[model samples]
Target chain A: MLQNVPTRQTIEAAHMLIAPYIHRTPVLTSAFLNNLSGTNLYFKPENLQKIGAFKARGGLNAILSLTKEQLRNGVTTHSSGNHAQAIAFAAAKVGAKAYIVMPENSPQVKISAVKDYGAEIIFCMNTPEERERNVQEVIARTGATFIHPFNNYEVIAGQATAAAELISDAGVRLDAIFAPVGGGGLLSGTGLSAHYFSPGTRVYAGEPEGAADAVLSFRSGKIERAPYVKTIADGLLTYLGDKTLPLIREHVADIFTVSDTEIIAAMQYLWERMKLVVEPSGAVALAALLKNREAFTGKNVGIILSGGNVDLARLPFGKEV
Target chain B: MLQNVPTRQTIEAAHMLIAPYIHRTPVLTSAFLNNLSGTNLYFKPENLQKIGAFKARGGLNAILSLTKEQLRNGVTTHSSGNHAQAIAFAAAKVGAKAYIVMPENSPQVKISAVKDYGAEIIFCMNTPEERERNVQEVIARTGATFIHPFNNYEVIAGQATAAAELISDAGVRLDAIFAPVGGGGLLSGTGLSAHYFSPGTRVYAGEPEGAADAVLSFRSGKIERAPYVKTIADGLLTYLGDKTLPLIREHVADIFTVSDTEIIAAMQYLWERMKLVVEPSGAVALAALLKNREAFTGKNVGIILSGGNVDLARLPFGKEV
Candidate 1:
């Protein structure tokens, strides 16, 4: 099943296909952060990407790859976060209707974002089984193409474009690239990009300590599930998918698990020093680097700021000066 | 006194002088924002500038313009905001001591930022008279040169670099540019840049309704002071100076006053759509544009995001998810 998966060529093609739609988001560097970590860090700010996340890349690529006949009926996905907005935005851009199945308890902010993109909302129970069932039902009823958030080959290929741009835009070889792992779409895509475009660059996954399944699976050489998922990095709550696991195992150098406290601190650092409004999951990669500063000291590191679709009202540090 | 003030040539020279020290901050565009305003808006994100404000440009240029004899004694400034950090950073870069006179009520976060840059802190009462007296005392004791936050010629020249970059970087002739006016440094500089770099472009000043001194001054053809300052845009509380007034009158096209509520709403809009962490002062320009959408419909407009040095703990929107 993994043999026919997306390679470097697929990512390159996706990059071209989505070039007109997406922004080549800027690469920002902070002297204060560099001095603190003793590393030359280049941040690929996908937080500034379309739909405020790298999910836009994958969503657009997947939707654009669909046949005219498939697009005629529309597309459907189940997500309570950035991917839902990504699909809605991508579908709108491609002139296709999107039916998004989100948990009823989804944040009003995320729900409104999807609605703003003109997607039809289908609310379901807050469980993987319910979401999957609802997504299937919608697809079956409408004959809409089901675009998996992070577990599909084309989505993975689309995500790889971010890393491709990072390397080419930075115009320097990165010693290591770190990305947050949730369903592993970004991490796997990062790995493939490093493997193909900049072979010498090592790829690492930053996982929340509460959701350490990705790290455990990478170490045990088997698929693993989180015993419990509870972290302020809300975007990294999901476990890895089968499509992403093999790619991570083959090309990823290591997986680092960081506590919620560390994630918050990294977010604060980004907010204060870099003046960037990155969401918790977006700061995970920097959290890992800051936690293990010795490992990346004096090296050129590339960090992917995954997204910035944060609930401003519920900031981690609370609402007080 | 205004006769020897900075012109466009001085701004171009300042840009060259501070080229190595300051960041040529990025100009970001949002399709979402464009659609909402019905204008093609280009955002000069000076919030990402060193010290998290365009103040860095003026502070650095002012400090660097000092003679060796002046540098030997050091620099002094009275500021409780981004200007304090800017002077500290600029002094450090120029290998000179910075004596910063900040109010005792200054936020701890800002105080720490100044301290971190190795500037000597002199606390005074939170009043203009007290701040001035303390700054004078510091200058007398250290024989340091005073770098006025926004009134000085070099500082005005430094601020103009942002507009210069925007016009050149965007590679388009803007119909008009909007900049928030506090002491009129940014607005004056923006006016000068438009006068020189983009001759056909018009410069508009965005003033807080609570601090409408600039707008009043513009309308009356004379300097004016705010009767009372009470706005979320704390950075724009200061009145315009003699040096800045001359330049503003000579080059600025108009001034628009926006209410505090509108400023907060615009700030929220930028946060949601642009994923930018701009302070209240930074949002004032966008607020004016949004308020008078008819004036700029389908026209190319440039907005200068003045800074991002807000006390994050006390966000405008209450802490309720």
Candidate 2:
């Protein structure tokens, strides 16, 4: 029965599997924020996690859970930045090497971060087919384990560990939780977390207005795609993966969208007022709360701050892309 | 003996006074940062405090300790920003009126925050004498007790509560601690904290190169002033106050300085890498370690993150001045 559910056991195992590699990021609460929202908001700051994101948990857990034979061969993955870095760091931690494929236009800061973790970088064409082909070729040549960034049970369970920690750390039963849905990895994990820890807790997904694939999928009761995805939250630009969608459908209660302007403004508010430096993707949950303040007022809400990996050199401040 | 000594008695009293009003901010440590610096660095995140800064401790302690007679009479003080907000918030918490004398050119965001805390704003000339005169005049007119922002014994002792909490929370004996020094409110308390909790621990004051008054004062064994102070760390603009100087002189081991560029870089590093939003003043301690990496390479060092009350609009990015 618990197989379909995200139990403390799975989260605990994921935690143990990724303990040495990933951060047990702090769950920070603010009376000031609580008073402002008329709600007790507990923020699980995964932004502070290693690789400056929660991708580390899934990436590390997946690499650690791999067979010794898989380690002997190596590991390969494709990503824009954070996932690549996460897998690279995990590979390094497990005494194995990683072959990471990336687009040429990826931020130098992210590229440098992945390189610093001793991952072999492969520049590839910025298309799904191209990335898949390159990754498959790496797997073929080196017999390396191809680690999916989000569409895998071990990865989803790994991401769920954040929610488990948040619930346990806060030591309170939350009324609801808001998590940003990218490929639905975090949502699947966080949704399962709410189901397991606080069964009555409602799990809502925050999506970028321009990239509301999760929202469409949840409302239609089927996997749906955003027409030509475009958002400043680069991490949330992906279409839902096959493994993530099914789990998300079973657990996610609702989904909401926030504007790009709202995202930046929310980021600024967190930085200036709350003293939290959250990246655009991580700011989505707070942005949704700010935009739809009426819906969540006076409720006990948990917001998972997904990541903080902004390249300061290329801040989207003045000119609109 | 108590004239220049910060006893446990003062800290106890301060804790009692401010316990109900100020926040017991979290102390977050990173194995990542520890590995990078080769030091067991415990960050007492005062950035998470009520007013987004540690000044709230001193401000609340002083306000709460006021006699019934003093409360009815009101209180007056002059500050740059964070302390102003802290004092205003403290006064409001205790149902007392506050008159805060602030420089005319202070940031609008800080000014609005102080005003929002229910303090009567008094715009004064930027000169120290002018600000003091304005504060005194307000006190005379309103029969208000003068609440010196950082010079008072109550304020210094109140700030000590943070160090006490840090020691209790971290549960580790620190070899040394680096705290930012401006009016010496934090350093005085930090010095006394070392004396009370871990007497063998040394407390070092971190200052900006532009505002190296405390460094000169510590070396000369006498109170000294910077020739002319101008740094991105707006909070560290003040010279060490009379009450704090003696306490620091007796307890503090040494003082170090870092450049403005180093401060900004540290702020960026913490925000981007550590996912912390620290002001330039707060980054000085870490900057000292980064600038002189060899000196602190294998030591167990504690750094008190003084505040995160940064105005993102005016994030001192590139310009020196």
State the C-alpha lDDT per candidate.
0.91, 0.83
TM-score of each: 0.97, 0.95
**Per-residue accuracy of model 2 over A1-321 as CA lDDT, tens digit each:** 234444568777888878867667777777666776778888998888888899999998888889998899999999986899999989999889899999888878778889988999998889989899999999989999988888877888899988888888876788888889889889999988888878988888889988988888776767788966778988898868767777778888878898899889777766666677688999898888767778877888888999988866555544221
Which has the greatest DockQ? Answer: 2
Poorest stretch of ten by lDDT in candidate 2 chain A:
A312-321
* lDDT, residue B229, model 1: 79
Give the poorly placed runs of model 2, Cα more than 4 Å off: A1-7, A316-321, B1-5, B318-321
What DockQ results do all the predictions give, each relative to the true complex? Answer: 0.52, 0.53
User: Model 1 chain B, poorest ten-residue lDDT window?
Assistant: B312-321
Tens digit per residue, CA lDDT, model 1, B66-141: 9999999999999999999999999999889999999999988899999999999999999989999998898879
lDDT of 1 by residue, A95-115 (tens): 899999999999888898899
lDDT of 2 at B166: 83
> Model 1 segments beyond 4 Å from truth?
A318-321, B319-321
- Candidate 1: true contacts recovered, fraction: 0.49
* Sliding window of 10 residues with minimal summed lDDT for model 2 chain B: B312-321
